[model samples]
Target chain A: MKKGIILVLVIVGLLVTTSFASVEKPVMGISLISYYNPFFLALRDGAKEALDEIGGTLLESDSQQDVAKQLAAIESFISRGVDVILLNAVDSEGVIPAVELANEAGIPVVTVDNDASGGDVEALVASDNVLAGKLCGEYLVEKLKNEDGVPAGNVVVLDALPVTGVLNRLQGFYSVIQEYPQIRIVSTQNAQGNRTDGFEVMENILLANSNIDAVFAINDPSALGALEAIDAAGRQDEMFIVSVDGAKEAMEAIKNGTSFEMTAAQLPTLIGKIGVETAMKVLNGEEVDRFIPVDVFSVTPENVDEFLEMATF
Target chain B: MNPFVSFLYKNKVTVAFVIIFIFFAIFIPNFLSLNNLMSVGKQIAVNGIIATGMTFVIITGGIDLSVGSLLAVAGVFCAMLVKSGVNSIVVILLTIGLGILIGLTNGLVITKLKIAPFITTLAMLSILRAFALGMSGGRSVSGLGDTFRFIGRGEIFSIPFPLFIMIVVFIIFGFILAQTKFGTHVYAIGENEDTSNILGLKVDKNKIIVYCISGGLAALASIIQTARLNSGQPLTGEGAELDAIAAVVIGGTDLNGGYGRIIGTVFGVAIMGMLTNGLILLNISFYYQLAVKGLVILFAVGVSRKK
Candidate 1:
């Protein structure tokens, strides 16, 4: 009779342990490619905030701008038995091994902004980067018209390279400016979307092209670079500048008159937050849409105050 | 006064630096202005401090390519801890510890693993750069407290804190070089490693120390860089080693190693900083500026090349 009582207690203990384990929140793994650029920083914060609200733990790793490191981060996530994984791939095709490992572990994977193609992630949460580019070009076309005067004169482009940001932004420029044949594109150089490099490259263009009427940069960093080059050349008032990525610094530039024109603002934090939320939904056995493309808006001096107050540098 | 003038005669480049400073003061708008002067002085603190440590390694006839990448890596780890509510000083200490470990690895890999310093450091460079970028998801670590930024942007008695740190670093390292036995060994090794080894110099140990110094200095640089920008850029200090090497070489260090001084590099780096500032003022294009920088380094090295 004593042995029977002991068995009963043991079974009860086992049942309690199993139930408590199930009651614990599911864990998620997230890998970020860098924290140097402000856009990704916002995304990191947004994702962290969302994960906190849902009671899910986030296992964060930084790839530090290396493809191999990104792959390692994913592998580390899988080994720890995370329920789901979020990846911001450094290179589009280099993340397959980690993605495959997660797939084998029966863990769902959601790719964040800047996807790793050919990997079967459950969903991709990213900005409509291409469409955002279109908006930028459209904005530029509208801004460059001088009292119904056609957009004309030599133009310079501070383009991003070998990526969606540059390609889409280029499309945006072409979309609106193609109609204005007189707006000649004098030069397009890859500044890699960096402010410091942007200044240097733009300085070269300014020296070579004396009649530049406008500049189209792929991102805010490049736009700021152009502003520096212009200022350095003592030609700040002669140019109309437009770019993408409405980072907080760009707003300051707009306010201070250091940089002229507009930026297509990508929803960096929103995409990050929604990505975490959607990943949770998937973990709960609910269906999430295959793609979430965040929208962007043109930020100008007219509405700059609101964004300035709301933005984080 | 005669001794001072003769001392100035010995370092013609440093004299030239002073002359240029005076020229800018007279000709350039806001050249001697407190803010502009502070900017250049502040910029030097990170590079100069790190270069001071690097001077030891270069004098010992070895090169360290991993300083830039290591800086980013160490910065990321420390910044991560800070964001998670760790005490800043504790984080800094832990980071210094991590830096020492990296430095030890560099020393071991070159001395024990039989890897050439160039190849070993180059590999570390690539690996560390990737590791830094991946750790932070290509984002920057931001919203660091004021105390941290103070290291980069603060001032002591109207002088930038970065400059203050840099001057202190120079004096400390300079004293070691001019007075310490270890400093003598460093020069002896660089001047003739095989002979020094035969003479019973603990070549392996000194090698390790030199690299350790390099790594620790790199950590210091990243910390200042993070404080200055108020964020740790996983991509911070990219291609920075080139500039450092140029400084050392143009300051009259023999590429064959063991024949340079920290003070010489100080002048070399100052020349670079001055040139950059000057070109910016001169409306030089970025591409042209790059060309000019390259040319100046080439010219300086050419002029200083042992005939």
Candidate 2:
């Protein structure tokens, strides 16, 4: 039995060496903030697929949503001398010094989904968050028109302050909503972009306002949370919710005809695919755009079913 | 000192609760409504359950910083088990057992190594959280069915199931602490460990049991929290231990131990819950809410001090 096991191990080792001997595989190191977000998981899967097709080995590390941990992962990537570094920074500014170190080590850095501030990052691949928010606002205005040929509603905004992406999305939504004079934003509260916070914040909002017509959540989790509160308050038929991030839960909510009406899909998998391709471009000394914007689209009850199959939880 | 001032110090938490409740009821619209009051009750139920156990540990003069992390672990495991078609009762027992085992490990180490509870539990906090993240692969364990949700979302006689659980925990633990021999030893150990040891009290055994209770309560709280959220998050109870500690302290429980009541913690949890709900109703920004909470904690600690 020992001899048989030894022979199998030798065969497996020979197969691995022979496969790698034909083509030199470029190594790509990925430092993600955390894998908790389904969006990030989709992103990782896309990057892995792209890298695999190119005969490149991917080294992945999770930073557990800590800036210091993310920096350490980047530092280790630099020490390992990988061909490229892909960073999904926990804190954009906090990641700059790590990006600088990578630059000093003569390794190219490609930031995906979030940018690193004050660094010569070779490229940044992120969804156009402002555009995403604008799409949702546009959809809401068109769908929420009254019989008097005007759009009007008292809206609650679920803000996740201190997150640049969320802020930008809100700003974009505000710009479009203000154009409709009859609509008014009744209250704004921070839900921190999580379902639990979203539910609590929404519950408080429900208590404060009795005539809320719509809700704009910074992300899908908050939107889903608001839906829960709406259901509990027995106001689901009256309240409408639009949010960013076409996450699986939101898509399910849409399919079920819940208060969640629309979601602006960030298409994280596409962003990841672009992220790896851009990293390879920089590694090959090919010209790549400093900022690459992945297009985002609005998902509604009308079109959400098409995305349900592809969405990751 | 005035007699009134002395009376106020003696009944600080209760007085504070009455004042805060009355203030919010008068100033905030719909604050006294049944639905809103129930909402606040449901929100604090998780904290209250964990704080009940925390009250025991704190009275015994030990801190369990690992409760929050243990909550996440229990919650994630429960969600995973439910997802894999495990029986709900068995899952509950297994998850809770895991928590007690971890707590036993904490107790054993602290007793054998003579380590400070603060330092030991702080280390356990990081270790437990890391284990949770590893087990869940940094993703939320979700898709739990309606039967599981009933624990968090269901209601009987218009009271949330979680609040009912919290009340039951408070009564059971409260009774044990106020009327049992184990409770007396816990107080003695917290007041003076060396003296308790000299008195031939099973100080180490009591401490271990206290920690195990804390761990078990945390697991129970996590089950309800997971049910309430409809998901098991790796980061579910992030910084929650602090909230439990704050609840105990604001209830006028001494950080130095041997000087508090579980009933005091009930009022403390209520105040914290109302404060949060009131701030939001007042249109306060989220940033300022943290500041207000900190100020309230300081004030509670101050008012509880003897002049």
Candidate 3:
């Protein structure tokens, strides 16, 4: 036992000496909603690029869409005394306490791609989600109008209601689609904001609404999932899909002229870049806007080549 | 034989934890700080609680995959109740009762129907997940009041509240496992169920109680999780059972059962928590983090195995 105790003490001493050897740099900690989605991966790549330019350390954690895990990540960041924190909240309201903790630590928090409900955030660098939704809605309406010369069709909405950004997209879609009297929303259901759930939900929706002329999925994964379900049911030619997030898969689908027609692409890479740049600005004692909006554009078959590389996850 | 080698072999789990802790402290920046250590403690509390109950089940040669799904169910139930203006204490009690009832059902179906624990719990996992999703309409139930949040977020004397709860659970369950007739019966059954039954050790009753304890503890974890997030998310505990099982197995619990200790599980939980916290602190990429964790778990288990 004495020998074991002496060995452990020696090891502990060695570790303590090594830990003090790390050099000081502007450390930026980022907590993403999850790494399962390719969008977040691209965002991380962008952030990493920006951080590397300044020779700063970037610490990242995947919260797996659990608010508790996100909170823990934020706490870890605070404990490490990071210069800035980039938060992609799993839940808008649930992340308030974590943000507040960062606030107490005097760490500037910049929300990336998603907004938090409360806390003193330095900025929210995100894409215009509402516009993305509006663009998809408008594209769907235009396609339907071109087909019939009057927007008259049954539309199905594959919704993911938990995310505020997705909800904003839905609101934008509603604002446009509600203007067309002939366009009727036949079915609306939650896809839980994932491909598997989207496919399962879309399969059920397809069975119930056989007359669906178009689908507006909340994001690319859901849109792709719906496309798969449509193909499985041999109804790919019967309806087209429009979604937000210009993911690589969705871009390929649009280019291949599959049922996926258009996607309102959010620049996650740009959002991530701007998030870090804004953090740098805040660290330099410069005033920045509370909301930093990144541009979003529609990706269609005609323009897929122009933006295909940018959508690579 | 060297005395040091013998000591290390006898307390492999604890030694493994110490070695791992020292490694992270050396390599990961700010990993040895008091605040970070506390943060890891708080983070591990939820899994630790579940693993404590899981220890009982695994020792009896059973597994509970449904604990994860059951956590979701209890979380949703607690959130819905809180949303409907139910008292915090009442909601906790009701949710716990729901967990016990589900656990009871799991026990009955396994024992009476003579279904293997794996198959029964696996089915329960799917059914309970569906129930949670159905009840919450596939959306997270949020806006849980502050009073309820205190259960998870509140701290006592600068220590996280969840850590205290986990300690209490470990203590009670540890005593029950180490110093009770039920505990011995649990081992007997795991070693040989027919022998235990023939010896009139009330095998079925003990098995039912073990499952009930597992389910009850899972519900307890759900409350802490719900309170921590300040919401009830249907997807809350996805893949959590695997984490518990990994902890139990890493702590020297045999898969075939009848051989483990609660103290070993404590070290197991600590080791797992340290790995997660340390990896992020070291700035390891998420993809590599998964691989490293698997390797470490395998290494720890292998080291702890008796020759």
* Top of the candidates by TM-score: 3
| lDDT against the true structure, each candidate | 0.75, 0.82, 0.87
Model 2 root mean square deviation, Cα atoms: 24.0
Per-residue C-alpha lDDT of model 3 across residues A121-199, encoded as one tens digit per residue: 9899999888888999899989889555888899999897656688789989999989999999899898877799889
- Expressed as tens digits, the lDDT of each residue in B1-307 for candidate 3 is 7899988888898888888888887666678788888888888998999999899999999999999999999999999999999988898899989988988999999999999999999999999999999998877788876778678768887888988888899999999999998889888888898899889999888999999999999999999988877888887788899999999998998889898889989989988888888888877887898999899888978877655
TM-score each candidate: 0.53, 0.53, 0.88
Q: Give the best candidate by DockQ.
A: 3
DockQ (model 2, Cα): 0.01
Q: Model 3 chain B — which ten-residue stretch has the worst lDDT?
A: B23-32
lDDT score at residue A27, model 2, on the 0-100 scale:
71
lDDT assessment of candidate 2: 0.82
Query: Which scores better on TM-score, 2 or 3?
Result: 3
Docking class of 1: incorrect
TM-score, model 1 to reference: 0.53
Clash totals in order:
25, 0, 0
Model 3, DockQ value? 0.41
Question: How far is A295's C-alpha from truth in model 1 (Å)?
Answer: 15
Q: Which regions in candidate 3 have their CA more than 4 angstroms from the true location?
A: A1-25, A137-163, A173-217, A222-241
Candidate order, DockQ descending: 3, 1, 2
